[model samples]
Target: MKAEQKFMMIFRFTPNFKYQPTEAEMVQMQEQWGGFIGNIAIQEKLISTYQLGFEGKQIAADLSVSEGILISENKTLGGNMVVKANSLEEATTMAKDCPILKMGGTVEIRTITPMGN
Candidate 1:
């Protein structure tokens, strides 16, 4: 068996502050996300996941702090999931079923690297 490696799935999507999803839509989204995560959890590949709140702060190279999250290229990071896979391709395959993609979002899979001294 191939050794399992840790990978991070970065989810990004376009933000629309003017429009809001209805209660039903919210419930449906919850189910979709739950199913997706559940599948990975069943395989024992899921490590952790996080959902980003819209509110945030950004710091500049000059040590200046700014309000609000950065939305570059019309998209902002929505959340991320860490998983274990045999390879990047395997991790990509797992990310393919992410609910965000159906919502016009993108998922980026990257290998998890530890800090170097």
Candidate 2:
């Protein structure tokens, strides 16, 4: 069998800063995310995952810093996941269960590559 390769699934979504989810809704979302990650973990394919915070600083070419997250085309990166898969198709199949898709978000899968020595 061929060894698995690592793929990074970058998650993005449009922010609704004015909206606040209710406690129950938050719990439901947590459950959904938990189940999604749990499923991948069960298969031993999950490498790692992360959720980005809203607060951020961006530096420009002139080294000037700006506050807040960057949103392009009405979408901002929400999170990402690294997983082991035989091919991009398999990784995509795994991402199909992502809860973000239900909320009109996107998951972009890219192969992981090493930096030169």
Candidate 2 ranges beyond 4 A from true positions: none
What's each prediction's TM-score? Answer: 0.97, 0.97
lDDT of 2: 0.97
lDDT of 1 by residue, 3-114 (tens): 9999999999999999999999999999999999999999999999999999989999999999999999999999999999999999999999999999999999999888
Model 1 superposed RMSD (Cα): 1.0
Q: Give the runs in model 1 whose Cα sits over 4 Å from its true position.
A: none
Q: Estimate, for each residue in 19-117, the C-alpha lDDT of model 2 and write its tens digit.
A: 999999999999999999999999999999999999999999999999988999999999999999999999999999999999999999999998997
Q: Candidate 1, clashing residue pairs?
A: none
